[model samples]
Target: MHFQWYPGHMTKAKRMMQENIKLIDLVIELVDARIPVSSRNPDIDELGKNKARLILLNKSDLAEEKQNDAWAEYFKEKGFSVVKVNSKRGGGIKSIQGVIQEACKEKIERDRKRGILNRPVRAMVVGIPNVGKSTFINALAGKACAKTGNKPGVTKGKQWIRLNKNVELLDTPGILWPKFEDQTVGLRLAFIGSIKDEILNTEELAMEMITFLTEKYPGVLEEKYSIEISEDSYECLRRIAESRHCLVKGNELDTNKAAILLIDDFRSGKLGRITLEFPEDYE
Candidate 1:
């Protein structure tokens, strides 16, 4: 399926990141644990070059544990200090301060050598849309510091929240790169609700989700819907509609309704923890 999702504000957000990166000591990037590679914007590497980097595998609660460990290891190997976190529930939030110190040890030491002492490390939180960046900031700050929403583009502008005497965080709006050259990347982003659902065909997106699950995660549909699995992904959606009584006109099965239900269930973690990309793919 063809995929496209780029809002005008994201362009402005990218420009903002470029202008502000010079003011920060570290870039704390949040990536969806389930789609670590897919959720990442390639431009961050260029935009944040020379800045200390930390990667938070956010929404760990919704992704497979083994994959989360592997992705963290993968980012760590790439020289990023990595943390697996469930931002919505405060998991892994407490350790962030210590990790930030560790990630920026060189900078902190440099300041000390120059006798510029006691200055906090300035960090900026950034990620593709709807990847829990705001929730992570709130959890780390131990308060409702950033506006929270499941929809993409909720946090409109930058806001700085001082965490303590040693660390301050600049929260920025979520931004997607200008385009997604790879359709798979776009699809994976869509799966995690990083892209707005209303812009795409829900039925098509759900069919792709069914296809991926049936191949990568066998029996997921069968167990979730209590229906026999089939070779065709469309048939699986039909079965889900039949089993769950998604009907129209008193008799006709509403596959579109079933599609939305299945997608919602996956997003809510009812279908089970799933990780779309594997580290081995990159290796």
Candidate 2:
């Protein structure tokens, strides 16, 4: 299946990020834990160069634990201060303050040397859509933190959410677009709902998802759908149609409907916490 991306919106998002990056001291990047590499748009590295980087593996609860550890180590090796977090449930949220301080330690040290003291670390959350950036900001800042409105010298209408005495976050997150030049990366993004559904056939995508699950997860489909696992993805899809009673008319199995159901289940974490690609799988 093929996926189409709008270059126009991407260009706009890049421009916005470039403008916003200049106003912050640290970039708190969020990546979908299930597809860490695929969900990320590497353009942020170029746009946020020289900024203190902290990568939050958001939705870590929906990913395999061992893979989460590997991804943390993977980004850490690339020089990002990485943290695993389940923003929805607040797991791993407490560690963020400490991690953020550590991630910006260099900046804080420089501030001290230059005789600048007690200046809060300014941060901005950035991520591709649906990677849980909004949820993360809310989780980090809570509801009680008031918006520090535009100041005299700062840009008008840019709100700063004071997370604490030592840290303040930009109220708006810097949006980034996922790179789609690589077909494999596009496919991975499509698999995770980062790409639009209209661009790809649901049945083909579900079959591909089943193929991957059968190979990597082993028996997830069988256990979830109560159907025999088959090496042929189409056959497995047919079994899902039969088990779920997905029918078009008069007992005719509706494989398309079943495919949509399977994909929906996978996306919503119903099929379980499944990570499509591992950090080791990255080039």
TM-score of each: 0.91, 0.95
Candidate 1 CA-lDDT value: 0.85
Which stretches in model 1 have alpha-carbon errors above 4 Å?
A: 144-159
Error of 1 at 211 (Å): 1.3
Cα lDDT of all candidates, in order?
0.85, 0.88
Candidate 2, 161-192: lDDT as tens digits: 99988999987644778877777788778878
- For 1-283, candidate 1 gives per-residue lDDT tens digits of 7886646776787888877787789999999999888888888988999999999999999999999998988998899999889999899988889999999999999999999999889898888878887788778887544432232332345456778888878766456553578888888888888777888788899999988998999988888899998888888889999999999996999999999999999999999999999999889
Candidate with maximal TM-score: 2
What is residue 81's positional error in candidate 1, in angstroms?
Answer: 0.4
Clashes of 1: 0
